[model samples]
Target: MMTNHICFIGGGNMAGSLISGLISNQYPTNKITVTDPDQQKLDQLKRQFSINTEIDNLKAVEASDVIVLAVKPQVLKVVCDNIKTATLKTKPLLISIAAGIRSTDIDRWLGGNNALVRCMPNTPALIQAGATGLFANTSTSDNQKNIADQILSSAGITLWVDNEAQLDAVTAVSGSGPAYFFLFLEAMQAAGKQLGLDESTAAKLAKQTALGAARMALEGDDDPTTLREKVTSKGGTTAAALASFENNNFNDIINQALTAARDRAIELADELGKD
Candidate 1:
């Protein structure tokens, strides 16, 4: 049981997932409190997790050792402003999970107090199979960083970035990476359907094949290319597929797509951080 009290500002899906992870992993459910404007959401969280609930955001913050800002990116500044006074008084470790919003911007909105950590976690976090990239502001202490790590690790994997700028790369790779895989899977399913397989059969095959391949990639000592090469024999069906993809410049397209994702992430940061 952790002695720390953690409060989440928004009772959204991501926050609910984290809370669910924490309780299931025995992180002292009584020590957690969630505040949201939606009474239904708050009631659901409280009933599901047997933790505290509040509509008074500042009261929750003042009672907490950590404050997780899990609100939407567009409304984050207003949330920051509303909670600024409580933050200054309590000085809890602040962790923001809103994407594309920088820590400097959060710090500025919070009256220039540091002790901030910004996290970009993908949708897979809702299932506790997430990959998260975290960056801490200069004012955060080592202890607070550890707390952030502990909280997020309950949901999935956590990686720290030395410079916040590299988070844009992280955003492109893992944050947006799931959707890319989903697109590929969707293509495989569609192709299977086109080949006369029933929709259910095609979906099952595509999903399981993807899961198995991902497991192989993770569990095997070989790199992805080596594994791919191992499956791809000369003048075989795999060879035919590879040849087609190569002819279509698949690798170049993937590179270009990820580059575009990174660039767009930067653009979003600029757009959301504007006064």
Candidate 2:
């Protein structure tokens, strides 16, 4: 249970997901609060979760020990600036879910207070099946890091990186990874339909196959390459498919795509953090 009072700075989808996850896991509703400018959002969230709601950022920030900065990347600096004075007094552990904003920039925006954690969570978080990557500033205490981990782990699997730049790679791999898989699924479904199956059947086959393969990869002790080798007999159907993938340099294409995502992530930090 999250014993500490927690305040969310935004009442959007990501924030809603986290709150729902926490409530499902038996965290006290009374210990949580969410602040948003939108009255409709606050009403919906309050009705659904029964947590406290606030229109004033400073009042919300002052009342909580953990402040989740769940605002959009474009408005995160403004939110930080607005809460800087309150935070300087409260010293709440700030956890940011905004994309492409570095902890250093957040600290600087918050008047040099350094306790912050930057998190990247994918869309699957809504279903409590997310993969999140976190990077903490040097000023975060071990206990604070543990709290951050626990809070994020409520949503999905959590991974931590020592170097902040690794979060870029995390963004490329898991952050943008879901879309890559969806694209592959679309191609697979189309190919199945072309192979004389109906569209519904093709889609079911493609989606179930993807899900089963993922489960196998996660549950089995052996690595993915060995699992593939186990399934592929020489000159068999799987071998033919592998040959086609190799011929098209599928791995290189994936590398290029993820590299583009990581580069763009870094570029975004620069673009968003510029004076």
Candidate 3:
């Protein structure tokens, strides 16, 4: 068991995922602590996984060997400032999951650019199928990074980037990618309903299609575009549907949306820097 204590400053869904992953990986439960303002969430965390819990972020930071910041972007600085004031110079490896908050800002708020890892993990992590993008400051050691990879990979796949700037593109892609998929699923369900299927039936069919298609893409030899082409025969139903989407510039629309999301992510990062 790793002797280094792990602490999360929030007990929301993302934090819950990390905590669960840590416990499932047999990292010492006694060495992990989660802090959140909500007593019910804390209780759930404690009851579900036999781990230590706290309500005070400052206290949690003081007691950690690896501090995971899993709070919202808006309140990140507030939390970081409080942690800085309460924590000793003997710093822990700070890993943040707050989207759009840069490591430099975290280091600044924490008083210096010490061991810090900036990460963006999507909502899928809750189900242990997430893909996370991680980047670290110069102060982060290889051993610390290995530890981070272990903790993160427990939930899903993890990719580390050399340039933190690429994280904005990652935010546009995977970080917010799940919602895009859910939107497509929702539209499919709605279309099914319009085609006279009942709500539950429509939902089930849509979900199955989404899941099966994803599984096929994963298991199939062909690439996604090739597979799509395979299903879309000339003058077939899929072809007709794709033709309509093409007429509406579907690919361009998606590009525009992602570009907007990426710009917004960068803007948010800049805003966080200001605060």
The clash count of every prediction, one per candidate, is 0, 0, 0
What ordering of candidates by lDDT runs from best to worst?
2, 1, 3
Q: How accurate is candidate 1 locally (lDDT)?
A: 0.92
In angstroms, give how far residue 50 of model 2 lies from its true place: 1.0
Q: Name the runs in model 1 displaced over 4 angstroms.
A: none
lDDT of 3 by residue, 99-122 (tens): 898999889888995799899899
Error of 1 at 154 (Å): 1.0
* Candidate 3 similarity to native, TM-score: 0.93
lDDT score for residue 223 of model 1: 98
The TM-score between candidate 1 and the true structure equals 0.97
Checking candidate 3 for backbone clashes, the offending pairs are none
Give all TM-scores, in the order shown. Answer: 0.97, 0.98, 0.93
Q: Which stretches of candidate 3 lie over 4 Å from their true place?
A: 1-3, 85-88
- Pairs with steric clashes in candidate 2: none
Question: What does the lDDT read for residue 238 in candidate 1?
Answer: 97
lDDT (10s digit) by residue, model 1, range 1-275: 34699999999999998998888788888899999999999988888989999999888988998999999999999989898998888888999999999999999999986699999898888999999999998889988899998888878999999999999999999999999999998999999999999999999999999999999998889999999999999999999999999999999999999999999999999999997
Residues 149-246, model 2: lDDT tens digits:
88888889999999999999999999999999999999999999999999999999999999999999999998999999999999999999999999
